[model samples]
Each structure stands twice: as C-alpha cells, then as structure tokens.
Target chain A: MAAKKRKKSTAAENEIINLTNVCKAYSTGAPALKDVNLRINRGEFVFIVGDSGSGKSTLIKLLLRELTITSGYINVMGYDLSKIKHRKIPKFRRNLGVVFQDFRLLKDRNVYENVAFAQRIIQKSNKEIKRNVPSILSVVGLAGKYKAKPRQLSGGEQQRVALARALVNQPTVLLADEPTGNLDPKNSWEIMKLLEQINENGTTVIVVTHNREIVNAMQKRVVTLKKGVIISDEEKGGYIDED
Target chain B: MRISSFFYTLKQGFRNLFRNKWFTLASIATISACLFLFGLFYAIVTNFAHIVKTAQEGVAVSVFFDDGLEESRMQEIGELILKRPEVSDVRFVSAEEAWESFKAEYLGDYADGFTENPLADSAHYEVYLNDVSMQSALVTYLESLDGVRMVNRSEIVATTLTGVNALIAYVSVGIIIILFAVSVFLISNTVMIGISVRKEEINIMKYIGATDFFVRSPFVIEGILIGLIGASIPLGVIYGMYNVVMDYVTTRFTMLSTLLSFLTVDEVFRVLIPVSLGIGVGIGFLGSVATVRRHLRV
Candidate 1:
C-alpha cells in the first residue's frame, strides 16, 4: 500500500498542469469556457486548436493567471491558481514562458537587450545574462543578430528574438499563443521546428494555433474547442474539419 | 533586491526620465514655479516678521513709581518687573536722567532759562517685552503692583504688528497648502502620461514576471529626478533674485534700511534650501506613488 501511494504521488508530481471542470464567464456575455477538464503532463507538447471566438484564447489566459477561473480548479506546476495571491503571480509566471502572436519584442532595444530583459526581470547576475542570452539566441538561430533592432529584422528574425527571450529564463513550460500567426509559411515552419526542438530538450510546449497545415503535419496531441467547450481531444491527431 | 537589480532599477529610472524628456521638463517646470512662489513668499514673510520682532523689542512699556517712593521700594519694583515671563528686560531711569533727556530734546539751545527741574517725578522703569502681543498683559500686571503709579504702552503699534504677524502666518499656511496640492497634481498628471506612453512596455514586463517594485521603480525614480531638478533650479533663481532685490531695496530706498532691516541671503537660504528640496522630492514621490497605484495595477 505504501509503494502504491508513493507511485500515486509521483504521478501527481509529473502532471505539471491540471484543470478540472474549469468554467470562465465574463460580464455581459456567454461563458468563455464551460466544464473544461484538461491535464498536461510534464514535457508534453500539445496544440490547442479552435476557430475564432472559441475558448482557446480563454484557456491560455486562464493558465497564465490573466483571467480567473469561474468554477473549477487549476493547478500549475504545484501552485493552485485559484488560491494564489496577486503578489505571488509574478513569481508563479517566472516558471512559465509565454510568446504572443504579435511577437512582442521591445522595439527600442536591441535583440540582446530584449532577450536580456527577461533575465533582468528575474534579477539574474550580469555574468549569467551575458552567458545565457547569447546561448539562447544561438539556439533560436539569431546569434549574429544580437545587436540588430526589431525594426531592422525580418518577421522571422523578430519572432526568433521573441522566442529566444521566452526561453532565456529556462521556464518549465513554454506557452506559445498563435506564435506563427503573422509569419509566412516558411517562417512559420521554422518557428514550429524551434518549438519542437525546445520540446525535445525536455520543456513542455503548449501551442495554440489556427494553422491547419502545420497542425495536420505535426501529428501531435490536438485539443479542439467549440463554443467554449472541448469537443475533441486526440493523441497523434490533426486539425479536425469544422463542419 | 540584489545590488545588481538595484543598479538596474536606478539606470532604468534615469533612462525613463530621458525617454520622456518633454513630460519630464513639464513636471520640472511645474515644480519650479510652485517652489519659486513658495520661496518668494517665504522670504517676504520672514523679513516682515523679523522687522516686526526688531520693532517689538524696541517698544518698551514705561512704568512710573508713586511720588516720593523709597529707593529700596523702587528697586523692588524693578526686580518684580524683571521676574515677569513676558518682560525681556527692565531699566530704571533716575529722575535726574529723565530731566536731562527731556531738557536736551525740548529745551535745546534755550535750556539756560529753566534751571529748576520740571521732570522730578518722571523717574520710571522701562519694561521691554519678548512679544509685542503680550504688552497689554504685562502693562496690566505692572499696574496692579505696588509703588507703580502709571503704566504706559504703545497699544496701536502692538495691535498692528500682532495683526500683521498673524495675517502673515495664515496667508503663508494657506498658500503653502494650495501650492503643495497644485504641485502634486501637476506631477501626477505628468507621471500618468508617462505611464500611458509606456503602457505596452509595462504589459510586456508584467507578463515577463517583473515584480511591481521592479516595474514601478523607474517611474518613481523619474519623478524624484524631476523634483530634484525642479527644486534646485528655483533655489538658484531665488538666491539670485533675493540678492538682487535686497541690493535694490537697500541701495534704492536708503531710509527704509534704518527703520527695517532685510535678512541676509545666507540667513534666508539656511531655512529655504532644505524646505524647498524636501517639498520637491516629497511631491515627486507622492505623485508617482499615487499615479502608479491608480493606473499601473501591475
């Protein structure tokens, strides 16, 4: 019995994110998410696919603690989001890296400064920043472009810079929300490959995207949301046709 | 709060000030204008009060003894007058000295006609008071004492000086309060604009797990720098202006100096410098804190 209990605890430890029957309702509108049950294990790469106005964005926001769950429980990397204090939110967020659709790079700063920003926020030592930022930039295939500004870079290079920034802090989970929304097909594939490489190196990657081609081609776990409800979740699944 | 982060926040704060140069200039100008008016008022009121104090010190109450009073009894009256808390000093004049002074003033050059002393009963005690407003009370107390025949005081001068002092105090307090409020409002608005301009940057910082202190420190620093510069400029300006005005008043109106003395620039700045800097920094800090609390929820 003791051995079984220990195994159960280990399983719980491996589940990095757990959401049970989560529901979110905004003021003066229908519920954004309804009775959602999702569990993302450690080092898992999952894609959240949905049409516009679906609950995919809502789920991502909920996980980021940007929006409060209306009803249900959310536990991310050992923190109960519902019970977390506002002051602790920043500390909690440090454990997760986030990339936005617009590739939110600091336009005024150079690529190195932009990536170093995250490290600075965490108060990393200057020596650590000097070491880690270049290493991550190199990983994202932008080592030579450290001094380049966001305006001087192509869309792909800018997204790469944003990716380098997100990974520079070595967060446990990388949450990419439509990361390739504005990129061309070749650039999108490049970003997807980088996300894949990041996942293979043992970081959990959750991608929320509407690109059907990439979604179908990658053949990863796909969770589809329709009208604020999870209609389908499949392993080795492609984008389900919305009829 | 590592030393590295501390330096970074300081650097960011200075960078932010330069980033929003126009807004920073506006804030500094607002603070400078407010402090300049404050310093000007302060100099004027302090000088006015100093003049009143000098005049009050000179306006003595005359106390006369009853006729034929014993020498010991007169001495006792002088000691009693000296014991009063309101009395700063007491001097007893002999009848002969009083007669000499009266004759010297009124009978100058024609004095040989009146060899007999007409002012024999004019021996009196001159009681100087610490505050002019307390003159009436001291006079009343002096009148109640034995061996005192009369107590004479300048009632109109005392009342006028006391009224002017009271008016200066009230006006100073009212104006300082109004100016403080105006300065804080102007600084808060400037900080609000800075926040709006950096709204996107702040949001990104928040997402990147920047603590509230980390995010807010730069703006607070910006406000402090603006206040510091604002306060410093006025001190220099006021210093120059005060000297110019003092020189102009003393040289231009030579007769006024004999009656009323102006404070030296050093003396005025000894009080004004710290007070102005404190207000400037305080307004900046309070303005930034209030703006951040209301607008930068992160």
Candidate 2:
C-alpha cells in the first residue's frame, strides 16, 4: 500500500515554466517587462500580483507566445519558447491552459459544450468528450448544470465553466488572468476555493489578479511585480508589501 | 485534420456565413453583381471576335496587271502567287473574259458599240486569302512580281476590322480585370467584418490550441461558399437572360442577326460556366486569405 502511494516528485522537478533575464518592449511604448527572471516548478500554485501596467498581462501573453520577446530565454514544458517556430505553437499551447477575466464562454453553447470545446479542439473522440465533459463539470461543482447556458449562470458559476473548459484537457499549467475580477466577495472566495482545489490535484495553477482579500486569505506563494520588476516573491505570503 | 474536426469547422463556417442573414446576402449580392458584369463582358467579347472574323473572311484582293503583258508571263506570276501558303485561291481573268463581263455589266444594251474588246491589261487574278491580315503582305509581294502592276485591296475594311478586333480585346480584358479587383476588394472587406464578428471566438479557439489551419480554414471555406452562391445566382440569371436576348435578336432583328451573330446560350455557357465560377471562387478564396492574414495575428 505504501509503495502504491506515489510521489509527484519526478514530474515536479521538470521546471514547467522558466523565465531567465526576459525582456519585452512594444514598438509604441517603453519596455513592458525589463530583465524579469522567474522560475515556476511543476505542480506549484502561485499568484502573480501587480498594479496596472505592471506587466502581468504581458507576462501571460509571452507565456502564451502571443508577443515576441525582445531578449532572454523562456522554457515551458522543456520547450525553448524563443526558438520554437510558430508552426509548433499550437502543439506547445496544448500543455498550457488559459482563462481570461471575463468568462469567455461561447454564448451560443451550453456549459457541457463549452467544457467539451477544449477536447474538441484537440480532436478527441465524441465518446471521450461526452464521458469527460460531465465528469469535469462535476469537478467544477456543475454536475447537473451541463445544459445551463452562460447567461443563466451567475458570474462565479460562469467562471467555473470557463475553468472547466481550461482543465478538461488536463494541462500541466493553468493560467488564470483576474479569475474573480467580476465576482462578488462570496463568489470570489468560491472561485479561490475552486482554484485551490484544482492546484491540490497536481495541476500547476497561476492566478494573476489585483484582488487583496482572496490573496490575503489564501496564504499561498505570491510574486509581486512593480513597474515590470519583481519586487517580492514570498512563500506563504499575504496581500501587500509589508517590508 | 481529423474527420470530426473537419465536420466541426464545416458547421462553424456554415453557421458563421448565415448568422447574420442580411450581411451574407449583401456580400453575395455584391459578388453576383460583379460576376454579372464579367459574364456580359465575356459574351460581348467572344461574339464580337466571331463577327470580326466572319467579316474579314469575306474580303478578297484583286491584283491587276500592266497592259501588253504576255498571257503566259501573267499565268506564271499567278502560279507563283498561288504557291504562297496564305493565298487560298487565285482565279485568272483572261482579257477577253474581262471585256465580256464588263460589257455585260456596264454596256448592257450598247454591247455592240465596243467593236474590239476595248479592255486591255485586264489579265489579272482575284486573290482570296485564308486570313485577311495577310492581304497587305501578299499585295506588297505581288507588286514586286515581274508582270504585276498594281495590287488592289480595300485597305479601309481590312484595317478597320483588325483595329476594332484588337481594341475590343484590350477593352474587354481591362473591364474584366477591373471587375475582378473590385469584387476581391469588396468581398475582402466583407469577410474582414465576418472575422471581426467572431474575433472573440477565435481568441478562445487559439487559447485552446487550435492550429493556424484549424482556425483559418473555416473562414476560407466560408469565403468559398459565399463565392459559389454568388457565382451561381448570376449564372442562372445570365443564362436565362442571354437566351431570351438571343431568341429576340434571331427572330426580330434578322439584319443584325445575319451580320453580327451572338453566341447561342449553350455555347456561351460552355465558357461562361467555368470562367464565372472560377472568378467567384477566386475572389472568395483570395479575400478570405487576405483578411485573415492581415487581421488574425496568430
């Protein structure tokens, strides 16, 4: 029994996301991220906190390989992003899931279809999509609400649908940008709890937000950015810079 | 790449094309209008070329000889002229035969007044050419012959027919090109709007790791469907309309029908069907590619 109880150590040491001396500057403006360095191990739950213009979005975009970097190396899932050709981007992205501030669910589709959309994109069989979508929906606490549309769901439940969509692929990294930005306090805490649950299941989850209460209560690893610079990286940290 | 994904994108493209019915109809209308003009230009150009060809085919050149030229020498010159590949036939006119015919035509009742066939130097040849453009060259060649004095071909008819044929070809090609550009430009903008309408959906698809082909192919397919419908409408309309005009012209305007012939509807459609469809699909495929290339960053 003890031998059967496995350890995640083997996969955890892979360094799922690494950014060394990274720089990104837009043509119309100054540098968005300046010589930023970060390392995220597999199965780690981390929060990326920053004020506006603090490069949170740019970092997410870079990880998505949506924006071309000015300098430095980024390796995700052992793929050197700077050298990875554009043709390989789609395959690379499958290992990383992303959720936006808005729910971004297909307005025409129901919760079940939305969740299954990710699998459909990866060309999963209909039987697999049918079997997996409901199970994933139950994991997100939407077990019987598969037929419910986005407009029918509350903001928190809608975010849960989006989260279900992102997690259906069982990705290595789940990136959430302001996941609870539109939810109230109760809904925000609910989303935080769901994210915590997802992280506990061995998926490395990164949440970027300006929310203070959830950050303070979560007591997770927090990396704070100020003007595109990493000001603090703390394990078991809180909301603000108390130093 | 898989069958399920193919069906998925196919459905998406169909739904997207018809999501806003008015918008799709407007795009089709614009495409059909352009294709209609293309069809008309094709009909007019082909028929005009045929008419020009027929008119030129009827023209023959008359080569006259000098007075007191030996008949045997003129026959040798005629044989030499006949050896030219361009000359279809050369009918030698003996001086006596010319006098007899001329008297029969002009001196009808007073035929006996010309006591001695007064026509000399009438031993020439009526030269029929396979192609009218060879007339001037043949005439120049005939003038340099030993016994031939003058080569008489109505330069006005030949030059005008050639000039009009070339001008029509240039003008028709120019119009077709302009219409093609206009259709591509208009369809591209319309397709750009369609892409923008579904921009959020595309972003989500990308986030879910849809390849460039997967994301882009639907729009391209959508463009093709639009083009097919657009082309098909004008095809039916123009086919029926051309037949009606052909029937009316053949029945009522016998003079114009005899002189300037129009292609039968079947004949016109033989070329029009494929060409119009090609233009339609070409516009759609190119428009979608251009819009997606410019707008969809990934």
Fraction of native contacts under 8 Å reproduced by each candidate: 0.74, 0.72
Candidate 1 stretches with Cα past 4 Å from truth are A1-7, B114-116, B294-297
lDDT of 2 by residue, A156-216 (tens): 9999999999999999999999998999989888888988898999999999999988888
Model 1 C-alpha lDDT per residue in residues B149-214, reported as the tens digit of each score: 998888999898899889888988898899778766766677677667777887888888988888
TM-score of each: 0.93, 0.85
Best by DockQ: 1
Clashing pairs for predicted structure model 2, backbone only:
none
Model 2, residue A1: C-alpha shift (Å): 33
Give Cα-based local distance difference scores for all models: 0.89, 0.85
* DockQ-based CAPRI category assigned to the predicted complex of candidate 2: medium
**DockQ values, each candidate:** 0.74, 0.64
Q: What would the per-residue lDDT of candidate 1 be over residues A1-243, giving only the tens digit for each residue? A: 999999999999899999999999999768999999999999999999999989999999989988889899999998999999989989999989999999888887899999999999999999999999999999999999999999999998999998998999999999999999999999999999999999999999999999999999999999999999999999899998888
Q: After superposition, how far is residue B280 of candidate 1 from its true place, in Å?
A: 1.0
RMSD (Å) of each candidate, 1 decimal: 2.3, 4.7
